[model samples]
Target: MWELRHRGGGGPGPGGEAASPPREGEAAGGDHETESTSDKETDIDDRYGDLDSRTDSDIPEIPPSLDRTPEILKKALSGLSSRWKNWWIRGILTLTMISLFFLIIYMGSFMLMLLVLSIQVKCFHEIITIGYRVYHSYDLPWFRTLSWYFLLCVNYFFYGETVADYFATFVQREEQLQFLIRYHRFISFALYLAGFCMFVLSLVKKHYRLQFYMFAWTHVTLLITVTQSHLVIQNLFEGMIWFLVPISSVICNDITAYIFGFFFGRTPLIKLSPKKTWEGFIGGFFSTVIFGFIAAYVLSKYQYFVCPVEYRSDVNSFVTECEPSELFQLQSYSLPPFLKAVLRRETVSMYPFQIHSIALSTFASLIGPFGGFFASGFKRAFKIKDFANTIPGHGGIMDRFDCQYLMATFVHVYITSFIRGPNPSKVLQQLLVLQPEQQLNIYKTLKTHLTEKGILQPTLKV
Candidate 1:
């Protein structure tokens, strides 16, 4: 669309004399023959004059090379494919890295929790640092300090609640922990109050708005990171499925989407994620659900993958059991009309939990990616390319797990609503930690209730 008709003059202008200098907002009028006839230095000066004539500040800037996907990957490959410039090499390398990440996660329950914690810390840092950078613009006092202090308070409150709920026995067996177990809420409130008072004291003239903005920013970051991560740990207590299934599903969907987009992408999915395409989104969804079912089936048969982490003092080590819930147990369900006709069977058997996995995968594909979209919007708002380039081509840890925290929340809620039951084992473990008086009282109460319901043994009734 651009035309460069102007060049060094061969002869003249409209008057057939020497050409005049171009006025402002006008393209130069000239010819090339005179420029070639003259020295090369004169031609270079004329070219510089053309460049200086126009205002280029209004032109849109190309984003930094480092921020672009191709450049990031090329650097990550250490300039591999420098000649042929194969960009897909980076995608393959990323896949290899992700495969290794899951391998470490599969090794143990502690490793899974460790992974979650690591992601949480990195995500929190990314968000808070963004807020901190903006805070200085407002000249706010103690904003960084207050934000981190609130983070600590919130984490303490959440972790305390988690331990008291999930590890009641652990808390009850220790006197110091018993006190915390009794008054955890009051202690948490006190810590929060301390931070609140500090914020109030730190407030300066005409800076209330900035302080409030930072307060909300810190809280939102905590919600996105600490709160959801705590739920992931709680899911671990239920079983690994609540943690593993959704995470794997999301990762699968992301990978499949990228591959699909790479090959067949045309229509954009959204402005926030410009590289995302309709082909990728649809492909990732179907693939995620199918993978969800298969993974559920495979992981269901394994004790370590299916069982909750529990203490085993007799063996002096933590262990998992193979007694899966009825949800995880295989059951027969009548097949659909087409499926039944194709298979020539009345029913096909599968873990009922696998059906639930379809729901998990649905959320992972459809809703979980919104978390990443939100992160994209956040970065755009700040004019940042990535949160940080912690990974070679992948941006940051937060960038990788933006969808994961949302997926973790969904899995936790799904388990609580559908799969979890009144756990008799957890209740018994709790009962074992009570004083003898309390334990006897509970026993009597249980016995009388059972007798009234006609469930007591005749020999023991007397």
Candidate 2:
């Protein structure tokens, strides 16, 4: 029993030198060895203790710093909180940015010029980045790089200063504008061809099917975006109905959807996008319709200033003393008979308030939400969460502008066909009652002038 006590005491046996407390260093080393042995024994005991009588407290205490449970949990919660805070901040910033962007864009023609060019370029870059991420995820390295460069070129050339100058010049004359549109078609065809070539060259081995689908999807999306943009520009819808209606409708829809979704959303609108709710859909629809009516009423009240103004010069052939600059001045002008007739017409007339407002409102609401749904479908198919995290609450450019693309297209078409009536140029030609020969002469004269000015080239079929 004494020998057993000496062994359990963790000291030398009795026959050896008398046991003494170790030096400081030796004592630490001894304690370490003992602790290590204790740890092993504890582990073994733990393995058997489940079937025995040992309790948790029997296990030796480790250093407080080594107790990782609270530390791990704290770290996890800190990271999550930080992410939440960042998203919150981002949401606020995005709201400000969007509000400012819309205000600047809707102010006037000059503002439209700056906003459209700059924002579209930024949007193109964002699109290219999204494409790169998508392609890279599938390990298509070639497409990842090729798409980036191609989009860069598109933003630089097609959407750059050259196109702006072309558009500005084209709009200066009706005949030149028609010619410019025809020219633009050729450029568009070239871009399509280039896009197809890049898609083909970026193909991966087993991903051929995916590549095909992606190509087709991209083409459709690009066509939609381009067509919408063209329609908006051609209508000169820079500030009035074109700009105001779509922007207001989209905002109303978004706000209504969020409010309803936050408060009353329960039933999922679609399984793919779990957050979207039926309540939100209904609320957004109603809101959009209400906003549309308000827009129409306001626009109709301000319709006089919305009409395009034309000026004509009247020259006195008998007077040879007129200065060249004086000849070009407004004082030398007489309002054309057409202009005089328009001036005589009643001004600032409001449309009769009718159910048309409700129809317009409902149409805007339905179509805009459909755009959002379509974008959601695309994201789900591609296995992407968001286009980007740029907007905080908004997601990305695609997210914010998705509904606008479709809404603008529908609004432009609707206004042109119903509210605006026949094309202005066609109506003017019809009203003038020119003979075929006279019309031909006018066309030839305009074409000749434009050709001589180098605005229309010999290669142009028109």
Candidate 3:
């Protein structure tokens, strides 16, 4: 069996000579030479024993907390087999979670942002815990503290950008916030620099490689969890529909695929996810596309879902009331000849947003599964069944959000590339933050351009 070599304090350095006592070391040093060489010499099979041969059956069962169901429910399900029992438990939990999700949605955008932030924190914790386990034998100083510090720094930066973008009026009301907003990037960088210095200071001789590995692991985790979650919030700001459609599409795909695979699966879809099958993939694609279309059509009719979330200074709360954009308005489309002949209609009225949902759904079905596969490969690399037992049926917050993050990124890109343009409201908000003279100068320039274009009377009074 493969075994990990544990090193004592003052272990041998590159040339296998007993090294001197530990001391603070440079962040970039020659220590990696020995570490890399040793890693190359180690047998891969020994390093991750049984990972190569482990099958789907190795997944762990439900914990005691989950297994102890209500007596009434237990009695109701007692006649079923173990498989059905598990299905019932998972189904019940899934419904409960969905109910909570709807409540969050009803509470409005701010609550949704809080939910994203909470999930980001949990996902970060789960991934960092794995890193801690891998290096628990080493007495790395200040590693955990610095990892969390970096997370705070990153969140500060991203959320600061969000505030500056969305809550301009609110920030303008506060003197302290104005200064912070003016130099937010610089402050964020300084905070990160402090954490970086702390990391370098915590590095010890003979543990340089492990310390660096942990550092990289912390950063990659932040990239996957924090950055992607930030994108999700940004999508929400675009309009709740932009956020809801993509997320719902992924959920629809996941559930429909599972249902289809559970009943009709025979051909394997991929080795990474053994349970995924061709039947599921195809069913999920069609189901998700149809769901996205209907979801978009329904959400588009409601200003609450289709309007961009904006702060209302008068009301002192965020509001989503605005003239519905062209994307949300019903537009006429000419049907193809074959379709017109079959349906006996020449034209169809639909919201433009519904058309965009097809693209979102297609990507969710095709590319989104790869995100779960990537997570699966990550688990297999560490020879673990799940990230954590945070959820009863689900593995961890990270596991539930793996595909969602990927979908979030694609939605953000799609909005920026296809849906969004220079926002007059955002520009007005930026101008509101400027000095009177600067604002006046821009006003005069815009007036001049308008006059030159014959769109405004040059002599009109302000």
Candidate 2: Cα lDDT at 118:
53
**TM-score of each predicted structure versus truth:** 0.78, 0.54, 0.84
lDDT of 3 by residue, 85-150 (tens): 877877887788889999999999999999999999999998998878744523788888898999
TM-score of 3: 0.84
* Best prediction by lDDT: 3
CA RMSD of all predictions = 14.9, 22.0, 7.6
Model 1 per-residue lDDT tens digits across residues 1-462:
022335534446688877764433353354555444344554544543343344434222324325344555557667555433444654665778778777976687777777778778888887887766644524778877777788888888988876666666555567898787677889999999999999889876455556676788888898889999998888887787777888889999888988788788999999998989999999999999999999999988877877887755456455788677787788999989999889999998899888999999999999999998998987776667778766645677888889988888888777778766676565765686679999999999998889788899645535
User: How many steric overlaps are in each model, in order?
Assistant: 1, 1, 0
Clashing pairs in 3: none
- Among all windows of ten consecutive residues in candidate 1, which has the lowest summed lDDT? 56-65
Where model 3 places Cα greater than 4 Å from the true spot, the runs are 1-79, 423-426, 429-435, 460-462
